[model samples]
Target: MRRPVPVFLPALLLALTVLGIVTVRLVVYEFGGPTARRKAVTVPPVDGVRITSMTVYSGRLPPCPEPAFDDYGHHDDPVIRPLPTGGPGISATYELHNEDTEVFTYTIRFMFLAGTIQVGAFTDEVVRSVRPGATVRGTVRPETQDPYTCPVTRVKVAEVTKVPDSELPPPPERCPPSGLRLTSDHTAAMGLRVVGLHLQNCGTDDYTLDGYPLLELLDTDRSPVDGARITHGSGGVSGISLPGSGFDEPAHPLVLKPGESAVSELAWRTDTPIVPYLRVRTQPDAAPVTLTLRLDLGTTGTLAVSPWKLPP
Candidate 1:
C-alpha cells in the first residue's frame, strides 16, 4: 500500500525555490545596474602629483549644453560642451605637489572604465600654477564625457604633461580681428612625433601665405634654446609618414579668403625629449605667436617643418 506524502514536504520545497530565485535576482542587481554602476577611481603612482579626496555620487547634469573654449573643439571657434558642473556625476580633486624649484602647470588625463570596458574617452584636467614645494588643488571634472558610472573603480591615468606656465603659449583660440588664427594638432607614432600647425583665415579680409612658418625654440624658462636647428622636412623620422609633410612640396603663394584655412606639419624624433615651447610666426611680417608645442627633440636637437599649403 502506498503511503501518503508529508504535507510539510511540499511547503518546504516551495519555500526553498522562492529563496533561490530571490538570491539570484539580488546578485544580478548588484552586478549590473545604475546603483551598482556608481564610480570608484584608481590612480597609478604619479610623481609630483597626488589624486585624492574622490567622491562618487548619483547626480544629474544641467538641462542644456554650455558654450566653452578648449583644444578639443573647433580650431577656430568656441564649441558647446556637455557642461556637467550642475553636479550629478563623479568628480575628483587632485593635489599637485610641485617638487621642482619653479611654479608649474600640470595637465593630467583621466580615463573611466566599467569592468574591463572603458566608459568613455580619456579627459584632461588641468592644475594650474603650482608653486614649488607647495600643494595646490584642481578638479578633474568631465568636460564632454559623463563617466559617472564606475569612476571610482575605473578612473585611471592615460598620461600626464607639465610645463612652466610662463613658458607655455597662449591656449589655442579663434581668429582675432587680425583675420588669422593659429593652433596645432598633436600626433605621435613610436618615437616619431608630429604637430600639425593649423592656420585659419577667420576674418572678412583675404589672407595670403608663402612658404613655411617662422619657428624658434624656447626652453622651460622661455629662454631661447641654443644649438637647436629647424629643418624643412620630417627629419627622416623612421616610424611613420604624414601627407603633405611640407618637405618635397615647393612652397608657393596661396590666398585664403575669409573662413578659409591652411596647414603645415612639424615632425621630429626623440628618446629622452627636451624643448618645451615654440615661437611660431605665420609670416615674418605678422606677429609671432608663442605655442607650448613641447617638441621632444631628443639628442637630435633638430626639428622638421613643412611649408604651408591648403588642406588635403
Candidate 2:
C-alpha cells in the first residue's frame, strides 16, 4: 500500500503540471493574439482645417434667370412669379473662403425649415480645387419639396488631401431632343392636381437627369405666361416620398438606359388657372420640349416636384 501511494502522488503532480501549462498558453494567446495586435495599430488623426467665412445667398441666385413673360394671352389677373422657397432645386449659392493653408474639398449641406420643423436637406459638393486663402462657391438646389426657408447649417470637409489640378470630370454629353420624348398624365386627388411627367429614352445612349426639369408655362401662341410664379414641390409639406420611385430620396443624378423610362410628379392646386402649354428643359442647355398638356397651377404659383423615379 505504501509503494502505491508514492506512484499515485507522482501521477497527480504530473497532471497538475500539464494543466498549468495549458492554462498559461491560453492566457497568452488571448491577451497577445491577432486581435491584440490589431488593437495596437492606430490611425493618425486628421488635422482640422478652418473655414474663415461663409456667405449664404438666400433668394434666387444667378444662372437661373427671373420669370420672363411674353405678351400672348389676355387675362385680367396680374401675373406674379412664384416666391422663392429654398430647398433641393431652389437656386441658392454659398460662398466659402478657405482659411487653411492647405487645399481641400468641401461639401455644403442645407437645412430647410418651416418654423421648427426640418422639411428637407440639400447637399452639394464643390468639385473645383479650393486653395488656401481662396474663395470657392457651391449651389444648393432642393431636388425635392421646396421648404418655406432654407439656410446653410453645416459644412464638412469631405476630403483633406490635395486636390488634383484637373479634378473636374469631363462634362456629360447632352442628350438630343430627338432621342428623348416627354409626355404627361394628370389626376386629381385630395384637392391637388398631380401631373406625372413621363420621360422616355428612345436614343441609342443613356440619358441622365438631375434636379428638377426647367418648367415654363406658355400660352397658346407659345409665349411665356406673365406673373406666373412656379414654386417646386408641395409648399412646406415634408415626408412626401413617391413610393417605389427614385425621386423619393434626395435629389441625385439618375440615368435612363435606352428604351427605359422615368417619371416625375408635378403637383399644383385644383382651382388654379389653366395654362395652355408647358415647356420643359431636361438639362439647362438642352433644347426645350413644348408640351401641349393643360396644366392648372393653384393661386400660389407654386408647384411640387417629386424626384425622377422608375415606374413600377
In order of listing, the candidates' clash counts read: 10, 16
lDDT of 1 by residue, 67-157 (tens): 4556777545434333222333455666668888887777787765444555557787777778889987676755554532233334556
The TM-score between candidate 2 and the true structure equals 0.39
- lDDT for 38 (candidate 1): 30
Best by the lDDT measure = 1
lDDT of 2 by residue, 52-125 (tens): 22222232222222244458744444343333332223233445666666665543434433334444553434
Q: Say what the RMSD of model 2 is.
A: 27.2
TM-scores, all candidates, are 0.51, 0.39
* Root-mean-square deviation of Cα positions for candidate 1 versus the true structure, in angstroms: 15.8
Error of 2 at 79 (Å): 52
lDDT of 2: 0.52
